[model samples]
Target: MIEDQLTEDDVLLPTYGPRPVTFTSGAGSWLTATDGGRYLDFLCGLAVTGLGHAHPVVTQAVADQAARLTHTSNLFGTRPVLELADRLRRTLGWDDGRAFFCNSGAEANEAALKLARRHGKHADPQKVHVVALDKGFHGRLMGALKLTGNPAKHAPFEPLGTWATHVPADDPDAIAAAVDDRTCAVWLEVVQGEGGVRPLSEEVLAAARAACDDHDALLVVDEVQTGVGRLGEWYGWQTTTVEPDVVCLAKGLANGLPIGAIVARGVAAKAFQLGDHATTFGGGPVVCAAANAVLDTIESDGLLAHTRAMGSRLAAGLEALAADSPLVTGQRGRGLLRAMTLSGDFAPAVADAALRHHLVVNAVAPDAVRLAPPLNVTPDEVDEALSRLRAAVADVASPTGASPTGASPTGAAPAETDGR
Candidate 1:
């Protein structure tokens, strides 16, 4: 049971409607709550913990870096940060690219937007417009939020600059129609995570690239959720033929540590000269050290291949579960970032039922339940999750409208789209 002390004192932020359970620690693909119960974690901190919880390599990197050097600010150089940047550039095969680091996915996107604007200014001062996809999420800061397409999130902050134009994903014509000479940049996710785990078609991504090229606009790919082997690639766009001028990554960069990066290629990289942009906490020693370890382990352990195999296994399991259920409509996504759609908006109920079975899952949208398990999740773990999910679906699909225990069904709507 949850302690009532916090409610009485009101010490925590009201932003989150947190569950009663408090996690004490985690290892591999499991988390232990304060009450001593272990649960399989499929959410993976919204796709941040790619290597899994308490990964030995990451833990050791953090400890060793903390003992060596933690922070020295952007005013000075750090070896780990430079090494990590070089490794990223080499791994992505973008030799002409430059990197700008930050503390979270949002900041990384903000920097990318800033770079786009600055790049445009160099060509034409009037080119300040940005184009993004509907149902696509970037980040939360003012600039990043402006690129986000969900109206519910932007409505409250109306009167936001009209610098951004929104278009539907996978609509090449719509994307082309939105871009013109005045547009500075076009932003999109290879797979829309918060927006129901929808993957953009190859033709659509190719069209966006052509449109950007035609109008001389920079293409920005938001890889916050899909980068670092989540999509079975170092960067999500690698799976596609399209090459973005700028890419933003974060979520799994440090395997749960806070780190974000904006990688720019060719002229886009030269757009930001000295004094154009900087972040004090960007690429701090400790986080960079952790990121280095993440990259090393990912390569050394062949987690990329593991992620691909496990993702297919997990997706097959989800399909099997949906095959016999009326509630599940379909499954979508690539690699580990997958979602199961329901016939109706029963995502929240399904999540609750999964919790009851000691599994952690999240409903990305009203009718979509997203699963971004750790890239290293084992086949046995995937099998267990499928079993729990099968039971959850059955429990939610029961006609009695009550759990087996005769309790009222919890009716909370699925959590909002991560404020995409």
Candidate 2:
């Protein structure tokens, strides 16, 4: 009955534009809209559902935990919360690591921000500055938004404090120059998910590590969309040559449940003392139980290796499409997080066409259509998505087809606007 009345998004806040479809149900790699059309899900809810919709492991764990105890606050200890913290530490291979749980990626980054500030003040009161890369998406909160590299997101909410300095993501020299004795932390995402799925260079990562070490700052990796086997590794930093002192995690951590955490080791682990920071719904048993189940399923199913293998398959498919299609320029990303860069800024129109053809994806940028499928996506599902995406591309690139952004289909720039 509610599904009948849910066709429009008028009652909700105008934070998001009109949604394309109202999903009624979903399984692995597929969702059923109200119209009974089963759409192939390649976006995985912006790379959050790594295990796919309604995963058995996560579902059962949440059910079992919810049936028992749900919340007890951080004032008391809970079994699932303690267990998840230990599991996250082991997964990161940080024996002395400590974790602070929250409810979303933004909250995780916000906590890390406070931790960095506190750690810096302990050394020197003036060392409160942070360095972040241009185009990096940290979070939407005031503190995390300031640390984010995108200025457009900060324009309307301007004067968000002058504590963070932004620099070029690919230029290691800029990174080195940005971090000085006054800096307390350097924030980054292994693969810039919201920045068009761009992967950072190893040289830049190494430079961040070296600068943090030289200046007594913390290297905080935002693994919100790249952690827990999404990048073919437990963490994105592990794929690079350099290791960060701390990592902000969310998205796929609880396999769709609202959960976030920052895992820190060495000095960063000890940065937060008692009564430093906290959350009421953070680290609750139900969410932690769901997270543990996600980790357990990854290990039991050997999903890290599976993710690498499937990623290769998806990469090969996109490359093949690029070779055949005129709209594609190239493809770039690590593991399952990828983008098919367009010849012009027509990604949003392509994405809109994709939805019409029963495929779920989004334009991570004006020219980059991002594809972040489930980490446990099967070979057949990957192939199906490619086939549907191929059709979507054809629908947009047809000679007589009408372009959504009113530009010619022959590589002319469609309005320079973000699709998502």
Best by lDDT: 2
User: Candidate 2: global Cα-lDDT?
Assistant: 0.89
Worst 10 residues of 1 by lDDT: 401-410
* Candidate 1 residue lDDT tens string, 1-420: 566455623777665665546789999999999789999999988899988899999999999999989889998988999999998898789998789999999899999998999988888999989999998888778888888888878877877898999998979999989899999899999999888899999988988999999999999999999999998988899989999999999999999889999899988988888898888889999999999999999999998888889989988888887889988877888889999888777776677788789899887886888899998899999999999988888888885543432222244433333333
Top TM-score prediction, candidate number: 2
- Model 1, global lDDT: 0.87
TM-score for candidate 2 = 0.97
Per-candidate clashes come to 0, 0
**Candidates' C-alpha lDDT:** 0.87, 0.89
True lDDT of residue 274, candidate 1: 83
* TM-score on alpha carbons, each prediction: 0.95, 0.97
